[model samples]
Target: DLQQQALDSLVQHLADHHNAEALGVLCDVADAAAVERAMALTVERFGGIDVLVNNAGITHRSSFADTELAVFQRIMAVNYFGALHCTKAALPSLIARSGQIIVLSSLSGFAPLLYRSAYNSSKHALHGLFETLRYELKGSGVNVMLVCPGFTATDLRKNALVGDGSVAAQPPLAMGKVASPQDVAEAIYHGALKRRRLLVLSNVDWRARVLARFFPRLFERVLLPRLSGLKPQRAGRF
Candidate 1:
């Protein structure tokens, strides 16, 4: 988490409710050095790493024309580079233990979404990077799982960045049934246990993935209407 207080709260909750031993290390995933330090501390505390979950992410809600270049950079820093940093720092420990790397990508990773160019591109990059890494680590026993979850009920939407980097005034419209974080977590846990390569949570996201891959034209026609309400008022420069 970005906030130490929230991290502490979560740690306490896990300890109290789940009787789980969890160390809350406050480190921003975008910062490579911080990630390294956090990973080192975890390895030191736990003796070795068994699983590394790259779930850090952020989103932006702005048309490409309205969005400043810095906004794209910021979003990429948190969503893409953040995962890259954690993966790099934890790779050696993961490899040593023949561990698993679970990446939390989104349906937008493959399918496009309106006014979310930065977010979509970052998730797409994760697929390209991690999927390739999976093949490279085939004999290493380090499983790489990519999780694509559809619209989940989270504060991510409320905290979405706008064109100028401010929080988005309005969250994007929900196209299908929104999933709960708990349901997504359960799916991820099962996927990891089975060492599944790709886990697309939710029926809606699964349909989107199929449509986007097999019928691009039809996907555009179907998805465009659901996302049309999200189009920015300002005319796109392109």
Candidate 2:
């Protein structure tokens, strides 16, 4: 079923998305060797890498106290190190083409999300790493862009791991309006084309920025739970 889903997504992309030449490979991004192989295959298929979008990520929903070290490590490997591997593997081609690296981070990267310490930490690391890379490669022509999209319509929560590292069976509680995948894609497309440094999609992401900037303590105590599905009573524990 997993393989079928992957193949279906590929088939659908081939059917309705890019031209007949777009390719998809089912490689684990967390594996550095697999990432390198994927890059090699991409070069063989596409001739060169022009734009690299590191969108693969995983999430875990549990209190920090309940989260195990393995859970934290697994999340970091996917969300942070996965990007690192792909970027490193594709750097040569990217630099040669003056390409762009697009990172699909979350609002949690900048603003903490309750019960998602590992996820938050991973995204924050991505921001720091890529932002620094932007300056380091300033004259190299390779541009880096980090996208922070708020909660969107996706099966992310369904695939998220629980406290015991099992797949979350039920969807999380809905917070507010959710953005469609198509909408988020369009924003990313335009932002990448323009070589923008940061793409903050949706008002929810903007609200995270506003809260983090304007009201630090109040944001932590007040709005974080609202965004994170954390009940008000257990604020101090996490």
Candidate 3:
């Protein structure tokens, strides 16, 4: 629903600007056939795809101790496999057009917090996949970008699954406050236009990455202690 709304708003804006050349919005679940069909439709209509954004993702609030095997797989299916399916489907057209592929990662990918085993692992996997892909496709005229956002105000947490596979009412965030989704979107757009290698969505996230890099021991000893506490646990567990 959020992705559709975003795409609708984008297409409406394009139509308002009288850009008839802009491709109409196409949305599909991150399934193999769906992704393939969507990619085919985009190529058939637009003649080529210039930018492919793998933004379909989901979050779950569950620790490994109580997290069900199915729940973990569900999160991976949506967040990790979903992006992989879309990228693979879009690759042919992207390569043909010498276009760009942008993967929306998260601060968790850089620094894992508590109770986000699935989400953190998914983004970490994405970071690894795309970073390597970037190197492989370096001279092929295809650009790969990773955009990591700290915390954005969205209904993602509300949709997060708890340990027992129940919905988590409140989504814990890295920062107490979240930046607007529009702000992150704007940054993503700018980075794509400029062909930037990586785009960090917020200052806090940037600091976390820097701290993880320059002061690994201090970050693990100091920062991890606080962030790790945010993981959701049953009341009786502690």
Candidate number with greatest lDDT: 1
**Evaluation by lDDT, superior candidate among 1 and 3:** 1
- Provide the lowest-lDDT 10-residue window in model 2: 229-238
| Tens digit of per-residue lDDT, candidate 3, span 132-210 | 9999898889999999876777777657788877888776554545778888898889899999889987776776788
How close is every model to the real structure, measured as TM-score? 0.93, 0.91, 0.84
Residue 63, candidate 2: alpha-carbon lDDT: 87
How should the candidates be ordered by TM-score, best one leading?
1, 2, 3
| Clash pairs detected, candidate 3 | none
Alpha-carbon RMSD to native, per candidate = 4.1, 3.3, 5.0
Ten consecutive residues with minimal summed lDDT in candidate 1?
229-238
Kindly report the root-mean-square deviation of model 2 from the true structure over all alpha carbons: 3.3
Q: Is candidate 2 or candidate 3 better by TM-score?
A: 2
* Candidate 3 positional error at 234, Å: 26
Best by TM-score: 1
